[model samples]
Target chain A: EAGVAQSPRYKIIEKRQSVAFWCNPISGHATLYWYQQILGQGPKLLIQFQNNGVVDDSQLPKDRFSAERLKGVDSTLKIQPAKLEDSAVYLCASSLGASISGANVLTFGAGSRLTVL
Target chain B: TQLLEQSPQFLSIQEGENLTVYCNSSSVFSSLQWYRQEPGEGPVLLVTVVTGGEVKKLKRLTFQFGDARKDSSLHITAAQPGDTGLYLCAGDPAGNKLTFGGGTRVLVKP
Candidate 1:
């Protein structure tokens, strides 16, 4: 029972630069999510994918951020022309399914900390 | 959009003390979840309550769901330093998404 796996534990980039983060969810999981957690705040959902399709991404900044789950197993989130405000931890989570029942519990990765200068 | 509000943005107490955190929402939910997150790490699920008025306990931690399924609470008894972390509450107002509340940061000193 391995946990959700994320890569590049830490990243630093200058303003107006670009950065990308990758995630590989647990095997057999059908739902995957990307969240941004700023200091002293709760993690905010950036996008959600159910299999290979997107379920929700209304909160995501379309102008600078984009994410995709190719083949429904691995995901990548990218930010271009990064801003200082984008400095935060990017967390990846996965669940068996998107059900209203208590069975839909999420497991998260260690997260990638991005420091935008 | 549904919103969950958490109380006591931050708390600090001595070890062995008891503390409680609250999560409230105006909209009813089908299920609610509580998670604990440490520095530089992602959140980990602690408990999930689905039924109205349901109560679940995990070791020294107790979680209760409101009778109306609109609120939840987490109580820690005889807290230890290891309990220090940010506590988050999320609600499944819709089957498709889980809305999270601003977390409550707790620090237990030994």
Candidate 2:
């Protein structure tokens, strides 16, 4: 039972530069999520994918952030023209299902820490 | 726009001490989950309470869901160095997405 995998562990980019984070969820998981955790703060949901389709992304900043789960097994989150405020850890999580009866437990990744100068 | 508020943003205690953290929200939830995260790793689920007034225990840690289903609490007994970490609470209102609290950072000195 391997945990959710994410990379590259750390990243640094100048303001206005673009950066991308990748994630590979656990085997057989049907729901994937991307969360942003600023230092000293709780992780905030950026986007959620159920299989190959998006289930929720209302909190995502459409102007600068985007994410996709093409085949439903893996996902990528990208930020363009990054701002200093964007500096935070990007965490990836997966679950077996999203239904109330399905346990709804989330297994998270180590996360990718990004520094925007 | 549901929000979960966690109390005592930080806690520092010596080994053998006891402490408790609370998570509250005005919105009702179908279930709530507790997670503990280490410095460089992601959070791992400690427990989930689905029924109101439900109480679950994990070793020295105890979790309880409020009868109104809008609050939860975590209590640790005889804390140890191994218990130091960030404790977070998340609520599943609709079972589609989870709303998380800011988290409680616990430091247990040996």
| Structural similarity to truth (TM-score) of each candidate | 0.96, 0.97
| Tens digits of per-residue lDDT for model 2, A6-117 | 9999999999999999999999999999999999989999999999999999999999999999888999999998999999999999988755644588899999999998
**What is the two-chain DockQ of model 2?**
0.73
Cα distance off (Å), candidate 1, residue B37: 0.6
Off by over 4 Å in 2: A98-103
- Tens-place lDDT per residue, model 1, A10-113, is 99999999999999999999999999999998889999999999999999999999999999999999999899999999999999974556557889999999
Worst 10 residues of 2 chain A by lDDT: A95-104
Residue lDDT tens for model 2, B1-110:
43999988999999999999999999998899999999989999999888899999999999999999999999999999999999999987775888789999999999
Question: Clashing residue pairs, candidate 1?
Answer: none
Q: Which ten residues in a row have the lowest lDDT in candidate 1 chain B?
A: B91-100
What DockQ do you compute for every candidate structure? 0.71, 0.73
